[model samples]
Target chain A: MPVTLKDVAQKLDLSITTVSRALAGYSDVAAATRQRVLSTAEEMGYVPNVTARHLRQQRTDTIGFIIPSEGPRFSDPFFNELMAGLGNEAAAHEFDVLVSIHVPGVEEEAAYRRMVYGRRVDGVVIVRIRHDDWRIRFLQQEAFPFVCFGRSEVPGDYPYIGVDGTLGMYLLTRHFIESGHQRIAYIAAPPHFFFATDRKAGFRQALAEAGIPLEKELEILGDLTQQGGYLAMKELLSRFPSADTKPTAIAACNDLMALGAMAAIQDAGLDVGEDIAVGGFDDIPPAAHSHPPLTTVRQPIYQIGAQVMRTLVQLVQHEPLAQRHIVLEPELVIRKSG
Target chain B: MPVTLKDVAQKLDLSITTVSRALAGYSDVAAATRQRVLSTAEEMGYVPNVTARHLRQQRTDTIGFIIPSEGPRFSDPFFNELMAGLGNEAAAHEFDVLVSIHVPGVEEEAAYRRMVYGRRVDGVVIVRIRHDDWRIRFLQQEAFPFVCFGRSEVPGDYPYIGVDGTLGMYLLTRHFIESGHQRIAYIAAPPHFFFATDRKAGFRQALAEAGIPLEKELEILGDLTQQGGYLAMKELLSRFPSADTKPTAIAACNDLMALGAMAAIQDAGLDVGEDIAVGGFDDIPPAAHSHPPLTTVRQPIYQIGAQVMRTLVQLVQHEPLAQRHIVLEPELVIRKSG
Candidate 1:
């Protein structure tokens, strides 16, 4: 037989109301009484049927994040940091984060629908928003509470906290120009990603500001992985073999690619900073420790994670938010690589 | 009005049994019939009501892992890799992974109890097992289905898949010894961790086999972080300032610490491989990218994760296992660092 609140109240000679309130973590109950009620409940093996409670309360008290696994591996440090931030903040708010790892498409969409319509979570947090992301449209149509780490080009009234990738890239490109690098190349990310286009545009804007003609040959597309960056850099080097016209510096959309680019340059028997400077965005933990310490754009990934969760929680609680749409500035960190 | 399975069956001109079996993912239903039933159910706005179904089935179809966050950060590549492995494997089996990030103490215990007694997850996967971990005792008492990544010192009958840390460290130490280094220092993980003692013992055993007297001062304790490894190496360098008595090789318990040790060696104006060989355990992704690359023990983290989930799912399904306990071998990766 399951123990009830009355059983615990009777055992402690306290009112059922007091026991319930104490167990509910209400501040109306005395601290000593709350402690006593909790211990007595545990001693009596009074298991709180959370499913029933969640159903009754009309809240699951869970947040959801669908992990976008790029390629075959999901060990990207950026995602890890973001997850850590989300998990830490969610836990602090007495909430748990449910993760669904699926590639974007039919399966990913089904996962989201299952979580949202299945009532498995109170709210959701989405990342890597594309220009025409179907996930956002579904969430908006369902009127579910959610927050995104990246903004989409698709029009919608939703809360999002994103790093200004365009400005970030512009600053990085300008830094290279200041270092007397005129023949600059960019290891661009896949064009499908919204931020990829923004980041590349920033690089173009910086080149135009410096009165440097945009060279179509200098822009090499990469998949944003270490290997992708390496291959892209190799392609760029091969395209411009002569030192006189070859790019003296290369800026990757992210640090992983930049690190790969560095490896390619080193493999070509050229000095990293002496012969050609390299820069990257998203200074993940390894960026500071990379061979010569990669010069990259620093995104407050942890803080961004915490803010996204906080925003989602606020929306779940129907609380008024001071600011819904948050755009955080990305800082350009200079290190030995550049 | 809530849509029921019978309502969907009526709309599709099918029997309720067929509709129920199809929705439950039973193989008895024909593929075309199942698809027709599912589309009809969706068109009828039928919500499966997973909570009610879970209560009846006594399964959540979810796997749980409590992420142990250290300090204000949860960026440990080991945990990230482990999580990715678990997430990928679990998702493949149509199981969602529920993560709770909390420091080990009251909150952690509460999170576990909430998931277990609350029936939020069907099974759990635990990592970083301690000698006398309360979690193990509690889970054992509850008779819950679970799998551990690390073995505990406390005697208990449970299934676990762990790497042979002792042998891994011993091989690493032996490699350093074969390089003609008699004065080898060890940067060990915190003593509380089970692998810490095992790894340090292996290092000692290697020295013993070489007929080298063990110096008590040579065993330095580190917290398994790059920062901890860095500080520990600095201490070791200070302890033996002279070149003649200074240790020729330093073996860290993990790669992060080994990377830190490398940084320390470079800071002290010494070449990494020539001045002193450095070796680390757990060849994480960055280990291969580190300047001079790092020689470390490579654990198949992704495969280990998939195996753990497979084992847990097997147990949950009440299947017989040919082997309950498994020990995986750690490979010695030779890189430029050593």
Candidate 2:
């Protein structure tokens, strides 16, 4: 026979409401009382039923994170940091978070469709928004509570938390210019992703301010990947008409691509800093340990998750968000690469 | 005004069970039927009571993944692979997995203690067992169902899935001996870790069988870090005092340390393939991309999580497990490092 909540309350000589609040991890419950209820419940082997199942607690007490179905190789360092932060906060809230990856290649749409409809996550946190994002649209129409890591270029009045990529790129490009580089290159992603576009805007804006003419050949456009950068760098060097004035420095949109560009430069028998200074964005884990210890933009990756979670929780609880668009600053971390 | 399951059933002219199952994503229902239920529910603006406060169907449907609170720097290729694998499985099951980090200098043990005691998880998955692991012991004595990433050294009664590190090291060391490297060095972690101790034992066993004398100078111990490996290499090179016959090969227990050791060798102006061979265990993502790709022992990090989950699901269902100790094999991958 399954032990009932009533049985627990009766056994503990307490009211059912106290037992209920304590069992649910409610913050309002007194710590000592909650502990007693929890211990008693565990002792009784009481498994609370999730919404539709009898295995877990009545409330899912779970948050969901959805990463756009980006390619497998395209998994960003940003995701890892954000996840670590979300995990940290969720644990503190005694809430479990579920992360769903919608790989762009196979059945991307189906994953989100299932999560929103069936998985019925308590709230959802979406990262890496692209232009014409169906996800933002879905969340808006569905009125599902969500928080975005990077706001959509075509945002629809949904609560979002975004990092200042524009400022980050501006700072990175300024660093390269200050390091005594005249003709600079930008290893950027295509103008599809909002993040890519914003970063490019920042790059071009900084260069324009410095009175440098932006050349099409200098803007090495490719997917946001090291291999893409490697291949792009090869094409940039070979395809460019002028050999005498090769860009003295190249700034990558992300660290992985920066590393790849470095490899290509090294393969071409050019020193990274001596021949051409290289810089990257997203000061990922490998940024610190790279052969040259890459100089890049350092965004508070972990804090973003915590803030996003807190924001999502607020949305779920019908609390007023003082601001919808929460922007975190990206600091420039200079190393041997720049 | 609340849209109860009964209200939903009446509106759809279907039984309450059919309506419930369809919303719950049960396989018994037809796809079209499930679709209809979802569409209707969405139209009704129905949000399931995640707290499970009022609804009898409040099952959280969330799975708790207790990430070994170890930081990213401490993790090599093994933990990352496990996470990737776990992510795939968790997504497929339509369940969210929670992640938490345990920073070393920060509140490491207390962080874990809080997460578990807080009743945040339905079921916990533990990674990397320590010698006096309070978490494992707590789960065991309390009969809390858990799956460990590595087996406990003090074996004989715990549910765990892990690779045979001792056997893996023995094979790799035997390969080194066969390749005509009699004087070998093992760049490994502190002796406290079970994997390190087991690997050292394997190294010793291989040396004994090959009739090679064991030398203390050939053993380098430090933290499981790249810098640690680099520092260890510097120490081994300076203090060995045997300039005539230095170690011909070095095997790090993991890839990060191996890469560091490789860097250290380069800093020492020694050729990798020509002068000395270096290898590591648990083939990390960057291992393949290193200047000379590292040879390593490949553990099935992904399958470990899936298999552990499968085993855990069985435990949750009260199904009989064939064995409490699930031992996996580690394969030797030959690369440029060795």
Candidate 3:
């Protein structure tokens, strides 16, 4: 059997309560006694029962992030970067990050309930907020400390840090118009996502402001994947077989799709920038080095990750937040592709 | 205060020992008594004290994977895929995966110690083995159950699943030679990695069999990153100012570097497949969609991940294994670039 609190207390000739308090980092215990107790416990191979400690203290010292995965595999670099950012910052704060990857459905809901009702985490960071996110409602009902990477349409008082996707898309579309492209097209993400709705709205608003009539044929939906973009672009191309009728510029909701669009253009024996200007949102690492390079809207995902964690930490500590809702500006980056 | 075991027992008019055993899912408890205890606990909002239960069972139902990350942000899709595989498989087995991202050194060592000594996880899955991986030694000393994604130079009786990197490299090199290329260059990963040594040895072996002279200038070391590959390729180009002296083919250690090399080659006013045959390892998703596509060696990373977890679960349960050392074959996929 492993060494226990009782074993340590007996070895040190101290009370069990005193030894427990010392190891718990409670200031009520003498500093020298705490040191001796810690060293002896380490020497004796005393592994702390974390579940017990968490039960008594009502804190796990761990933050949780449940990936809103849709399928069997998730390969989005955006999440990878965000996770790295969260993990690094959480580690710096002496906290561990517990990541639960589950497709959004019954399993996902059960995961949230288990983590919250079981007291498995101190707090959580929610991402990929839907139009009517049930998680926010559940978390709020439980009075749980949590923060969102994206905001939901559901009315609630909660902390969130969101990139201004609508404005970013507006800026990108405006840049395309300024480049003397009257016929422009947009490849959008599935319409249910909050960012997808916001970004498409921005695109439409820009076209209306520019006195360019919105063409129903030009706006196509993509599954926010490279293959989805490729198929959407091909469909868009098929609608206008002639150079005079086709859109001179295309804007995708993400860089991966934009890169795919570029490939589609190349496959059609057309020069990317000269024949068809293409741009994407979220200047992922590959955008800068893509063939002919890609113009995109840059979101500070790393900083957003750090900020989200800081807010969640504040909420966990029951500290007052100066501003619960943070909207960071997105930057427009013009390159050879657009 | 929240409801406790005593409160549930008093409410049900039952003994505390019966209530505890029922909640613990012990078969000794009568089915009817367990049902009554569960319903009462749920009605009273009695969240099971996981810590106390863990203390009695000596299990956390969690597996750990510490990423040997070496930078501010890690964006490799390889790890993302592997993580998805591990997470999905572990979830199927009613286990949670706890990931810790830390660079290899003092902090990483401390993380292992903490996870092991704190009883935070039941077992671990190790990745990215090096020439002298200290993690293996440490885990062995603790007698902790672990399964490795890669093997270390330090031989030991441990469970591991490794890809045949040496044979894969030899095949790739031989393919280049069969295409009538005498001056083939290689962009290798950091020398400290065990795969790097094995792959480079294969490259040398292939050239020796072909009766080709080995040129020290043709071998370059990259940091297993796109930027590293870009810089290494640039350096390789600088060595040969004339077209006649430059290498006719190039092989990168991974797809990211290979893509970077392709970009560098394009920037130098040269066609990828025609001017210089370019290939990479790992067959990452982008490799197939890259401009001109990339020839690569494919390692079944997803399967490898699932297999690693299976072996780990077996070890954790102290079950007998048919074979502990599993070496999976790597396939050479020929694309336009090579």
lDDT of each: 0.87, 0.74, 0.87
Relative to the unseen true structure, what is the C-alpha lDDT of residue B233 in candidate 1, on a scale of 0 to 100?
93
Q: Which run of 10 residues does model 2 chain B get worst, by summed lDDT?
A: B52-61
CAPRI grade of model 1 = medium
Candidate 3: tens digits of C-alpha lDDT, residues B225-253: 88888898999999998889999999888
Error of 3 at A97 (Å): 1.2
Off by over 4 Å in 3: A1-8, A18-49, B1-10, B16-49
| lDDT string, candidate 3, A1-338, tens digits | 45779999999999999988888899999899999999998899887766667767788888888987767777676777788878878888878888888988999998887788777788999988888788898898888989999767878888898888999999999999999999999999887788899899889999999999999999999877788889989999999998799999999998889988998998888889999999998888778888889999998777788888888887898889999998888999999999
- C-alpha TM-score for every candidate: 0.93, 0.81, 0.95
- Ranking of models by TM-score: 3, 1, 2
Tens-digit lDDT string for candidate 2 (A1-338)? 34667889999999978898898789988899999999998898665433334125322556777665346422455566677778777767756577666676346666555556543466788777778877788777777778888867665788777778889999989888887788888988767788898899899999999998888878878677677878878877786546567887888988878888887887787877778788888777767766666888987677777888888877776789989887888899988878
lDDT of 2 by residue, B162-245 (tens): 888888888889889989999899987776566778778878899999999998878988677777888988887786656567
Which residue pairs show backbone clashes in model 3? A51-B51, A52-B51
The 10-residue segment of model 2 chain A with minimum total lDDT is A50-59
In candidate 3 chain B, what residue range of length 10 has the lowest lDDT sum?
Answer: B48-57
